[model samples]
Target: MSGPVDPARIRDAIAQFGRTLGPDVLASCRALFGAQQEALSCAVPAAARDLAYGPHERHRLDLYGAAGEAPKPVLLFVHGGAFVGGDKGDPSDPARWHNGAVGRMAARRGWIGAVMNYRLAPDHPWPAGAQDVGAAVDFLRAHAADHGGDPDRIVIMGTSAGAAHVGGFLRLRPDHADLVRGAILLSGLYGITPLEPKDEEYYGAADSACDKSPLEALASTPLPMMMACAQYDPARFQAEYLGLLQKRLTRHGALPCSMSLPGHNHYTIAMHLGTSDRRLEDSIAEFCDRLFA
Candidate 1:
């Protein structure tokens, strides 16, 4: 039998296909990505909790934890679905990578893991989605005591589109600053610039949407942050955007810890957090520990 699979080669293959494939075919590609995640060997336990924030439909928060009485730190996760598709419940499904791996891993680590669903795109749009996330945070804070969580020690984590929502939350509602002690943003999109020529309908014009960019929203507030991405991500501009945001943060005297997953692709890097990979998940846990320490 051959040696273990090479993550670099896997990333390169995905990036190549992303460049060659049309936008409509991306969903199928994403499904393939999910399939890859499900094949990994890891076990974590998760539970479902449903609650209503306001007039919106009852949202679900997936909780993960080891069976113990320890009052662990809370990690609130928001999944990326391009502001169009994706459910917190979907990630928790056994068929998917994100819900199965990451959510379970967080719980196994003695954290009160919470993955929540927010309103999607077109039907919801920018701030609406961010507001939904904010409400989830509020709900968690209000009920953390009941869930055996320390409301003062909460970390907001997100990937891709979900990361954008976290960024928006930080920018739009500074009052909620106390609600989150730190953030973990993975392969996230921060700039409001369109990813494609026809993406203007969803992302809006770049010039006028500058305020919507996380980089811009971060100009005044200096929250501790950790930004990460994969080297072989087809979305190369995401790295560039992170760099720009880093530079801005530096100029504003706010330096964020950052990392580039050496051999992983965008999908793999994001999903790896769900695995027992000490290299990634441990680092994230360490970061949060220090932030709340």
Candidate 2:
């Protein structure tokens, strides 16, 4: 196996990607974590933009597709922002992660990649994100063919809070089970206890939290999963990943293929997705590709 990336160089690269030469929003990720370098997700152009999956202001997604390709597998990415704030696209900068970066990577890999935005918390509360995910799936399942995506082959990839929403949808009685072929959960909360006040607010009541915990709910007839965390992630998230891995192993007798993104922390891992760092990307692709095959 290759060694961890040089944190110093990774830090410099992150500043470059954000088009901010000095420390700020993206650069602060490392400083806040006491880690050398955090992840920086870069972006690219979309074949289409601001496509509405639902009527809500936030229920929109961006599509990255190969022109004239009518039938390609789809990778719909759900972003994370603690369930309070996050968007699918960053119209202000190409250096930011969101629709462009991830979608570009998926399109490059010969799949129809997409990034979506959904209602956030405080106002929306628990299950709102999951509901939005369901709507996005429904939209894709019905119309992916019109935009060169094969509705039958769709994978949902979520990070952090987004993973919680994906988890909820996965256990939503498998109604759209056939449409969503696989899932990739990165540094997810998994409904574990001791949530911060902000998380508690967004997730709602304690009883509601129990109902929403992905780790507990995923035991029976869980779909194929890829559970991952970063080397420098917050200790809590690392624990969450390990717990999920153990759950999968004990229940299924085999661990789902997962990884620790070396030289990466929670925020930095997703940024590496569109870059040359293929360790995490390759593992995710392999997992999804096998499902498609």
Number of the top TM-score candidate: 2
Candidate 1 residue runs with Cα over 4 Å from true position: 1-42, 66-70, 89-94, 192-208, 252-254
The prediction achieving the highest lDDT against the true structure is 2
RMSD of 1: 3.8
> What lDDT does candidate 1 reach at residue 185?
83
> What tens-digit string does per-residue lDDT give for candidate 2 at 1-293?
12455546665544444422123544454333222112332233577778899988898898886645358999989888878876775645533443355677788788898899999888888778988898999999998888898889999998888887888777664665666887889988875546767687677766556666656555544577788887767788888888878887899999887888766666666755765567887898899899877
Q: After superposition, how far is residue 67 of candidate 1 from its true place, in Å?
A: 6.9
What are the lDDT figures for the candidates, one per model? 0.66, 0.73
Q: How close is each model in CA RMSD to the real structure?
A: 3.8, 5.8
Per-residue error for 31 in candidate 2, Å, reads: 13
Any residue pairs clashing in model 2, and if so which?
39-268, 41-271
